[model samples]
Target: MSEVEKRYLAAKERYAKIGVDTDEALKKLQEVKISMHCWQGDDVKGFLNPDGELTGGIMATGNYPGAAHTPEQLRSDLEKAFAMIPGKHKVNLHAIYVDTDEKVDLNTIEPKHFSKWVDWAKEQGLGLDFNPTFFSHPMFKDNYTLASPDKEVRDFWIEHGKRSRKIAEYFGKELGQTCINNFWMPDGMKDNPIDRLSPRKRLMEALDEIFEEKLDENYTQEAVESKLFGLGAEAYTVGSHEFYMGYGLTRDKLICLDAGHFHPTEFISNKLSSLALFSKGVMLHVSRPVRWDSDHVVLMDDELTEIGRELVRNDLLPITNIGLDFFDATINRIAAWVVGTRNTQKALLKAFLEPTDDLKKIELENDFTTRMVLTEELKDFPFGDIWNQFCELNGVPVGLDWLKEVREYEKNVLLNR
Candidate 1:
């Protein structure tokens, strides 16, 4: 047997002794589909933009030389990145990335605009998730939509939301899988306003009108994502977590919890149980936030592992939808996706390899000292070997060998771009 196979055999036997089946862990990890965000490849600069500049509180900082210039390039780069990842995955798309020949305004977007994407996704054996872009358009210059004072502007946005749901349904029908349609808005104030209540009421009414036309639930699932704050709206966000949590429960929609959307001290791991109890399922936009809501690439941090553990232990994988949401233009764009995705996979693998059943039993028995020691000892297990074996089984490059592949892709394809 190969060195990796030999190492995995040793690790498997060791884990089995502790009542943790490494073979079953690897199998479970394979079933997880981390939804990759397409915006990372193009730095949030979609094709519809007149010029590739971000506005309306959306920002991707870095002048990376090899950013994908077109939808074709973005797909090519994503394919390279996906090839390096060792599991089934999906892609989340913003409406602005729709490929079309005509200038399709926000309210009039049809399934045809994204037909090519559906085709590409089918070819890759991938499902799709969607987001309606609510910022950076002339219609949102006043920094409000679905909560705007002007009836005309509010109605226009309502139409967009309704149409977006239709398109999402179409994607689901075409792909033969359920598609999650996420709705997030940048409607808030830079400074405190006198009439916060009025705007929120209007926002609720607008959302009511938007969801009035219910589509087929089997094809598409709807979710509302709430943000803590934005650049121009630091003082208040109309779609606060409280608002969306209640809204999600009442409306029977999934609540999307972004890691960076909460305060620095808040972790999504703790919030998952509360949401899973009420909402049908929770959607996750996993991003690394250093100090604020800056969309940094994900890493194998403590919180990521805990988040994975929370999902695995709670049996929430079937209900929870995990997706990446970050853009870093400073590094090679494809490499960013590869590294972030691999880290995320590694974290999940660690969670699965854990003796959570026994740990919980210890906690139940009030054996705190023993549980603590066991938890710390688990940190030094042969997790790397299991990960390597997983990559090998999935027919992907094992260990740092994938890093060499990414570097070669950058030099040959990205450098030329």
Candidate 2:
């Protein structure tokens, strides 16, 4: 037998000796809570009525609509959105963008708007989340990976990072909600190799700045306490893909793996989850993968079921929050809300039913081949069936037939590529 096969057999023997109960493992998985990153555009579906004065609302269909509003409009919209969500479904707000054409100014925009949202969230009991990127601006079109040798481009990126730190600090103090900065830089190419080292350096430098701001001595006197900052990176970006050796992997940051983002690259989602668990990050961005683009559609049967099982085995946090990172102009706002929420709920239920110990053992095993096989198995599980099984096991009422509805909606709405 080959060395890898021998290692796998040895690992399996060790696990067998310990003997995990699948039923008990499934129970533990059920305890994990799920949440979603809220966007203004997502609320326009018919489930919740739009407060006309506010930019968006939860529609009857259960999805939210993207609302690209001015600062003033955003404040009002957030107030309404918080009031609409049921206490059972956790709501995570997206990074506050300045405008459609520009990235939101953290210093100015977050302080005013974020403070307002915090107060409103407190009243409603909701959490906030954000994505960290400088891509929205025209200047960052070249890169925010921080490798630009050009002084002007580098300076712009630096300013953006500084803004992100200030914003994180403000949210930490005012909201007490952990600020999750999802860092996905449009800064690399598959063919052309750039100064690969600089991007990582720049990312670490920006993180250090944020850390320093949180530790600033001046903030000790504030009446309100700040939230701890958590950082998450997209599955793949410009330069090197996947977790590479020698790259400084800090414990402070969590790896945010998007399901749809990795499908085309053959980057194994379950293995990525294990790496994130090994490194220790807060949560994962659970969404469906398609083509090269993040279809951001609802969870597929095969994709998320496997991820959910792996999460349980690895003891990774399940959908601490969900991000419907999709763009669809055709679907009426109401349909979007229903679709997003339904898909998220379905995915979470399936993941919650997975055997936790099985996942945990796979994660703890030293054999790389066994881990790889486990990850592959997880990616192929029947997630939709698992979700139904979970609902039946828990004796909870399954409210909507979202898969059928979404299929119909996609036929009419999803734009041709």
Candidate 3:
């Protein structure tokens, strides 16, 4: 037998001895569908206007050459990124990425504005997710949208939210899969506000208006995301975690938990079980944080592994909506996508390799000492071998071979621009 076949057999025996079906684990891992963010390729600039500079708190650092400048280029770059990524996936888009002949006001945007995206996704056999762009416009210069005290501003953003939902419905109908429409606004004060309650009250009123006209839930899922702070919004975020969590539970909406948006010591793994208790599904934006809400590319770290473990052990994969939300312009954009996405899969696979059934039984029996030792010992198993077999089965490059492939793309395609 070949080397890969032999290694997989050996690893399979080891996993089987621990009560894990290696083949079943690999199959389940393949069933995971992660939505890759399109903003990463273009650094969140989208195609709103060629001259539109980065606004809001989100900014991708570095003068990386050949960042996508147009819709066609962005889609082309995504094709390359998707090729190296192992699993079939969806591409996340902000409304600003709409392909149109002229600047379309946010409130007036139609599904026609995104027809090209739908056509492309159909052609590529991928699904699409959407976000309402609440920043970078002149109206939001005060750092407010839905939560603004001004009635005119709130009404305009409410219309935009409605339009975004319509477009998400279109995506779902056209692609035959539900599209997740996420809404996040950068509304807060630089310093302590004298009237925080008023803004939040206005926000609730506006949201009530936004969701008053409901679309079919099967075609469109709405997610509300909260942030602790942004560049200027240091004192308080209008849509704090508490705010969205309560809103989500009360309204039966999905709540998004961004890893980088919480306190440094807080981890999402610990929150999964609690989240699963209420919401039908939770939206996860997997990004690494370095001290603050700095959306760094995700790595295969302990916290990430634990997040994966929680999902698998709790049987929450069916209810966990996973997506990547980091943009690092300093490196080759394609490589960043590959590394972040592949590392996420690696974490999930590591979780799959664990003998969770056995570990949990031991824990229930109150044999804490043995449980701890087995947990630690399982880490040194031939996980790498199993991972290599997974890549082989999926028809992707094994180990570090993809590094050379991405370098070639950078030289021939990325630097050409």
lDDT agreement with native, every candidate: 0.89, 0.43, 0.88
Return the TM-score for each candidate structure: 0.98, 0.60, 0.98
Model 1 lDDT tens row, 1-417? 899999999999888888899988999999898889999998887877837467666798888778887888889988999889998889999988888898888899999999999999999999999999888787885789889999998988899999899889999999988899999999999998898898889999999989998788889999999888888888999999999998999999999999888888889899998888888999988888777788888988888888888888888999988899999988888878988888888888898998888899999999999999998988989999999999999999988888899889888888898
Q: Indicate which candidate wins on lDDT.
A: 1
Model 1: CA > 4 A from native: 50-52
lDDT of 2 by residue, 39-133 (tens): 43433211112233111101123333334334444444333322222223344444443333333442334445456555655665555455544
Number of clashes recorded per candidate? 0, 44, 0
Q: Could you tell me the lDDT of residue 9 within candidate 3?
A: 96
Q: What lDDT score goes with residue 156 in model 1?
A: 87
Better of 2 and 3 by lDDT: 3
